[model samples]
Target: MPPLNDDAIVLRTSDFSETSMVVTFFTRESGKITCLAKGARRLKNPFDTAFDAMNVCRILYYPKSGDVLQLVTEAKLTERFRVDSTVAIYAGFHVVQLLNHFTENFSPQTALFDLTKIILNDILSLNPICRSASLEDPPEKLSRCLLHYELRLLQLVGVAPSLRECVECGEKIEVRRGARRAAFGMREGGVLCPRCRPGKTRVVSLSPEALGALQLLASPEERFWKRLQLSQKTLGEIRGVWNQYLAHQMERPVPIFQWLKR
Candidate 1:
């Protein structure tokens, strides 16, 4: 067949033999794919010797059927992320993990791929030093970035969490005193209005503050990031709510959230 060429982000890399390596890439044209880079592990290899998580690169590969590995003929690095904070480092790891786990092989995810590149670029540009940096709180800021990216990814992958209304009854959740205490319906797959609250046993109270944070994260406003600030309580609740929602929806836990906690 023809050579597949695309802009891809390195999601994973593993040594396949003494001199060969298997690299997993998430590309704009192909959602997720693996290729065997022959002799890539040598001291000086033709594959640039620069495959790592978060590296954006141009890749050319030849496909093969079944369990046989596809040959990655060429890989040229386009961008590499550099962040000062350990949390930021882990956040990149989390991004790669999500791609490797959630994406389907050879299926194009152009929007998600573009957005993923943007997320990594933005994270490194901020050059987060630590949670105690003078610019902002490290964990708080990085977590918000990661959460925001997750929300966007969820949208791209057709699993966006419902925010403005109830998932069951189509009732628009009112942002007022009594109605502000909305219930997060995990199985129902979104926030449930109090009127439709009794059916689900896995429901948890989602405060307006926490919901507001989710709204901001799901928002497209560029200035929102600069103005984004979350109190510890609100952040915790948002994390908890999304954690349950994501876990229930994916039928497994999302380990990336733990990176923020650390």
Candidate 2:
């Protein structure tokens, strides 16, 4: 059969032999593919720096049957990630790590692939002046970028937390005026209305401010992140709730969250 051609981002790589390497890529046409790039480690190989993590490249590979690895024929670098800011670079890695975790091989995820590219571009465009030394107290722009990417990735993966209605009773939630707190059920899966709040052992209370910020983060509006302003206390609340929710969904702690939160 003819080789399949598509755009892909390098997700991982490991040495296979003295002159070859095994690579995992998230492709635009194919969701995730692990392939052997013969001689990729050589000085003059079919793939050059295209295998570097987070780099985007155009790849040609021959697909295999079940449980068999694909064979990469040719690859050319199309884009390389900027290394100006440590915060931005870590954010990019967070994006790639989630993509690696949420996707399955041989499945097509074109929309997710496009979203990844957009988020990477946004991270790359951050001003050096707006960046910090680490993920702790990240600049507003970088924070927004990461939050948007996390929310969108949840949506794409079909596990987005429900913020509008009670996950238990399916009732629409209405926050009363001067309401200070709301309930979220991590295992039961999202915000819980007052009527459904009783007798739940796993529910956690969230600040109304943090809840509102979450709703905005989940919005489809392209510029919603920019318009939403969150105070430090509220940001911490949101991050805490979000991290717990993620841990519940994945059944384990996300390693990147440590670096991101620190």
Candidate 3:
């Protein structure tokens, strides 16, 4: 096929040969693509900046029929996100990691792309470390943000857990004590009612506030995130639920959380 022009964000890059590299990018128009960047490792390479992870660029490529990799012709950097803050840097990596794991090649994820860009911009602008430090209680706020992003990402990918009612008996759960003990059956893809928990089942405990926070995060409005708040205990509960849900769905544990724990 003839070379085509597209705008994309660099997801990853690795050395291919003496001077070239195998680069993966998620494009605004063409979705995820793996392209061979000939001579990208050379000092005088024109597409040097475009090969950096998280950098948005415009690329020209020729995709042969039934070929796994595309041949890159030209790439021009459009946005070089200078992430000076540590939190911002980690946030950027989290976005890239999620896209790499969850999305299939050539599948359109325009909403996910836009959401990631906005989140990255927010992380770059705010002092996440300082914000966490000054809080009445501090407990890995950056990690919490990452978890929130993951939950929303899962929703966008059509795998978010059902929290409204029990997936088993379709009963609306009532909050008890300070928390609501809902049985999150990973196999069933949602919560289980009290009556339906007769047999052995996997479940995650969530506080009333935590459930509310989850609902808010799953909402449609991007600006609605500003009004959302959660306590330390609630955040921890939500994180556990997200981790369990993601692991069950993906069949592999997310290592990014391990790095963030440090």
Candidate 4:
């Protein structure tokens, strides 16, 4: 097989035998791929700094036809995410985990790659800004940004919940008393009108304002960041919705979320 060169972000790596490593990377052209990095664990390994998760690199690999994994020939680091900011570090880990676990292999997910880069850059930049701001503000900002990234990630992976009319019935929903007069159906993948929501439906009550905010968030736009403005309560509601939706779609709990609670 001919060598292929691409830009990639390391997603995860595991020790393989004594000197080799099994690495997973999200590549620009080929999407997610697993590669065997021969002798990458040795002291004089050429891929010494290139195999770390979240490090962007230029990689060369050779694939055997019909094989599940490729052999990495060369990898050179392009960008190494700074580890100085704890918040950025955790956020980077979350992004890598989502890419590694949620996304399918070789699916041509270009948007996911671009969005991940944007979020990581934003997170790194936020560190200095947060340091200059009030003590309580950083966590709030980080949480809001992370929530937005998660929502965007879901949309990119084609699991974005329907936020328009009822997911079951076609009727539009109304909100009352700071709660959706309607209920959200995780199984149905969207809001359900009161009449359509079964007694057994798992619903998260959301306010009219919160519902409106979510609609705006789900809208695909290049300038989404400029348009987003959420109150703390509304942010909390959005977070809850994303949590339930992701849990349902993934069919298992994500460990990184537990880390977020700490």
Candidate order by decreasing lDDT: 2, 1, 4, 3
The stretch of ten residues in a row with the least summed lDDT in candidate 4 is 129-138
- Which residue pairs clash within candidate 4? none
Each candidate structure's TM-score, on Cα atoms with residue i matched to residue i, is 0.90, 0.93, 0.87, 0.87
lDDT of 3 by residue, 189-260 (tens): 777777876774676556667676776777666566555665656766776677677778889887755443
Task: Let me know the TM-score candidate 4 reaches against the reference structure.
Answer: 0.87
- Evaluate model 3: give its TM-score: 0.87
Please, what are the lDDT tens digits per residue for candidate 2 over residues 153-206? 889889998887888888876655578578899888888888888988788888
Candidate 4 local lDDT, 23-133, one digit each (tens): 999998888889999999899988878888888999999966564779998999888877565556767788888778778777778888887777777777777654544
- Candidate 3 residues lying further than 4 Å off, grouped into runs, are 127-144, 174-179, 259-262
The TM-score obtained by model 2 is 0.93
lDDT of 1 by residue, 55-151 (tens): 9989999987765678898999889876667667767888888767778887798888888898888678656345345323455766678788888
Clashes of each: 2, 0, 0, 0
Ranking by TM-score, best first?
Answer: 2, 1, 4, 3
Cα-based lDDT for every prediction? 0.78, 0.83, 0.73, 0.76
Clashing pairs in 1: 31-107, 131-138
Per-residue lDDT of 102 in model 2:
84
Which candidate achieves the best TM-score against the true structure? 2
